[model samples]
Target: MTTERAYHHGDLRRAILAAALDVIAAEGPTALSLRDLARRAGVSHAAPAHHFKDRAGLLTAIAVEGYGLLAATLQKAESLRDLGLQYVRFAAAHPAHFQVMFRPELLRPDDPELLAARERTRNQLHTAVEGYSDDPAIGVMAAWSMAHGFATLLLSHNLDGLLDGRDPEEAFLSLTNEMFQSAKNPATG
Candidate 1:
């Protein structure tokens, strides 16, 4: 960061968080350092301290951003099946955020913004499964597990053979549709 700075240019917080995502995507979160983030953002090493206090703060920022993005993604998908497919797509597109967003042990969960964002994400998912009133909790939990597991497998390439050369979008939709079939009772619909 330019030591010669004014409020107009330093927007250090956004810069640091963007750089952290870039570094995490390329090298994983464990490789993240406040200094490395500063270097990546072309800021002086001390600049990040003004925004993130420490590495944990940086992580909390990442998690908060991840939750906000997740909430947006799930909100956009009009159906539970679509939301599940989008979850897989999100994991593929934003692996860095996806990697640590759900791992509660990695960051301080009590951070108010993080908690609020996370709750928003959960509510988005809950709304997606709203049609399954017959067994809402079980259906929501099962749907959540299926989507999370399939996305994890698909993004990780563990399901490479199962994909059987299908286009990724079609494959994601197919898997989610199949999962939806199992999660909700057909007689009710």
Candidate 2:
């Protein structure tokens, strides 16, 4: 029953986004609603509409922010393996954002901000794979697919008992090394 007046003093856009992330983490993205976000932010339902037009807009904003955060994290990584590790860590740290960032059907994929942010993230990935293999594009794709698949598995708890009691990071590093080693020695079938 709070009013828009409650949001008069601060950045309502960021507040609404934080509420959306909380809701997404607790109930999944399908449960997100501007009205629910407004309730969590202690504002009128229409307040979120002013900031995010609708649910797709809100999810688009989240995707943009997620990509920017991912780009920053990847930029700080020192190597391809470190970049992969950072990708997994980012997913673990921001599951809500990670969930929405890759689901294009749930976001406004044509949004300029979202597109730019995605490109920045892709550039970071490409940079990580540059000079690591004969075909940089394929190398980038392979590294991205492996990191994304691993992060998704971890997020879904599929790696719980499969890790055999080893720490997740240690297990991930082992898997990453195994992948690279196998790439260096293709098997004949």
Candidate 3:
């Protein structure tokens, strides 16, 4: 139950979203619950429902926001390699959003906001590799896969031992540089 003061607060929605992100960061997306978020936010159990409708709705909102953020980050990149590095950095900086954004089953993929946000991200990637490949779509796919795979590996702690005491960002940049070099010169690869 929410205290009267909490119910009257103007930022309940933001509070709920922040709580949800914290929960997802600590326990993964599967553990997220509106009721728990409400408790964490000091709001009524029904408050989250009022804002998001349901679990899928909440996840959809997260996915939409995540895509928008990723698009904005990618837009700042001056090169294709920088774009890939930004992708990995975004995942590391916002693990909860990254997790929810990639799991389509957990979200309402057909939602208008989600679709628009996703297209923005796709466009950013396509523009980044526009001149690098004759088939830009394939280039976008390869770049997305490489960054997504590396981010997933980092998030899952699969690269802890493999990093050899280097910072994850440095290691990721090194790996991307090597990949870009190999793509440029297949004989050297």
Candidate 4:
């Protein structure tokens, strides 16, 4: 009789998540599979399942992690504009996480950890917006829309020609400044 060796890793969960991120980055989230993650992690097929019951659970974990990272990034901003810049920077730096974080359909949104992480990030955004605008809600929405849209455009290559050799961050900052300036003086806009 042949005996299968026990799976032993320093941190199987983190390993699997790292593998999953690589897969998502290279092929989008739809192509991710626990089996493939295990293969990438060099573990047994069932190893990933032990940590995450299914794809939803795995994705939920990723969403939670993404939110935590975003919260940390936003918290470091010195101003509302800096917050927006950080948001775009985070999205660009963590494209895989950014892709998964906003797709509620792909995650178990009711997961407590996911909820907490999301709330933390949202609070960071709201606090920053509140400091800058008379209408906090509208400010929050506009800032999020601008940052998310800019990141999406940059990531999808839609801004390739429009950027015209400018650094993405500099272009985003300039665009943000222009929009805010226009908002301040609608007649000039």
Off by over 4 Å in 2: 1-6, 187-189
The alpha-carbon RMSD values of the candidates against the true structure, listed in the order shown, are 3.6, 2.1, 2.2, 3.3
Window of ten residues with lowest summed lDDT in model 4: 1-10
Ranking 1 against 3 by TM-score, winner: 3
Provide TM-scores for the models: 0.84, 0.93, 0.92, 0.92
Model 1 alpha-carbon miss at residue 127, Å: 1.7
Worst lDDT run of 10 residues, candidate 3, spans 1-10
Q: lDDT for model 2, please.
A: 0.88
Error (Å) of candidate 3 at residue 37 is 1.5
lDDT of every model, 2 decimals: 0.79, 0.88, 0.87, 0.87
* 25-59: candidate 1 lDDT, tens digit per residue: 77878888998877766767887888888888888
Off by over 4 Å in 1: 1-8, 180-189
Model 1 lDDT, residue 77, Cα: 88
- Looking at candidate 3, what is the lDDT of residue 3? 44
For model 3, residues 1-189, the per-residue Cα lDDT tens digits are 354465576667777777788889999999998988887777778988998999999989888889988988888888888888899889999999999998999999789999999988888888888998899989888988988999999999999999978898888889988887888889843
Off by over 4 Å in 4: 1-7
Expressed as tens digits, the lDDT of each residue in 132-181 for candidate 4 is: 77899898899999999999999989999999999999999999899988
lDDT of 4 at 106: 95
Distance from true location, Cα of 29 in model 2, Å: 0.7
lDDT of 2 at 109: 75
